[model samples]
Target: MTIIQFPTAPALNASEPHDLLLETLRAATNQLSQAGKALVQCDSEPAARVEAASHLVSAGQSIVAALNAYQRGLQHASDQAAG
Candidate 1:
């Protein structure tokens, strides 16, 4: 079975919200990758594989919501600052 890995980030401080989101997404991707690998490895009674797949789906959905909220928040903050 292949070992899945996370996405690499360029050198950046983690204090920024965008950076934090990117890091979060990278982690999610890594998790999804590992889950996929787990599915491939199982090939039998798929309970573990199904659970891992569920994890991937949940993480992906959460990431999408968080990122969207972050973007909207940033835009609102920007507009407030400008005004």
Candidate 2:
């Protein structure tokens, strides 16, 4: 099994919403990387491997979208606080 190393950030309280979101994104990215490695090393039947690969791709895309949205939200909140 391949182990993917994910960077660890300082723990934050729930009240730190932006930090919490960032941490969640980091964890998700690490999980996605691990899934990709597993798919590459998979020795299952061709059809099952293909299906798992497809699901991983879909999940990765979703994570990217969610990360983008979270960043936008953080920016908006910062702007609001400034203005």
Candidate 3:
């Protein structure tokens, strides 16, 4: 098994879940943009560019999880408002 290590940014610092969600979503957008550029620019070898883009896309997993949490938070808030 080969283990590849990619560069990682520092963890998000936020007191609230919404703050983390927003920060995560923003990071995901940046990663998606860079991934698109990687494929569009083709600055490196085809396989290398694909690999780099794949890593970038994978790095955005936190966004997916954060979005799920954010949706739940919204639903909870809405339920409270309704009651």
Candidate 4:
């Protein structure tokens, strides 16, 4: 019999769950912001410009998802605490 093993991600040392989630959302927002600015300022070829634009769109979508998920998580936790 072969024993199966899975690798575990490193544990975080965040003092608060909300803080960690908020930080993740903030970082995602920052990434989108920088990508937008880069798209505006970058004077590269048309292909490169399109690539940057695509990256901005992707990052923005990811940020929205992150925020939505974080909000839902907060609501669930809050409800659990209240009840």
Cα lDDT tens digits, model 2, 6-62, are 333335454454666666666556656756666676665565466556656755775
Candidates sorted on TM-score, descending:
1, 3, 4, 2
Which pairs in model 2 have colliding backbones? none
User: In terms of TM-score, how similar is model 2 to the real structure?
Assistant: 0.51
lDDT of 4 by residue, 1-83 (tens): 22212122234345555766666566656666666666666565565566666666766676677567668878888999999
Flag the better candidate by TM-score, 1 or 3.
Answer: 1
lDDT of 2: 0.61
How many backbone collisions does model 3 have? 0
Off by over 4 Å in 1: 1-14
Q: Give per-model CA RMSD.
A: 4.9, 5.9, 4.7, 11.1
* Model 3 alpha-carbon drift over 4 Å, by segment: 1-7, 72-83
Per-residue lDDT tens digits of candidate 1, residues 1-83? 33334343344456656876787787767767877777777677456666667777866885896598679768987998999
Question: Would you list the clashing residue pairs of candidate 4?
Answer: none
Better TM-score candidate (2, 4): 4
> What is the TM-score (0 to 1) of candidate 4?
0.59
Each prediction's total of clashing residue pairs, residues at least 3 apart in sequence or on different chains, is 0, 0, 0, 0
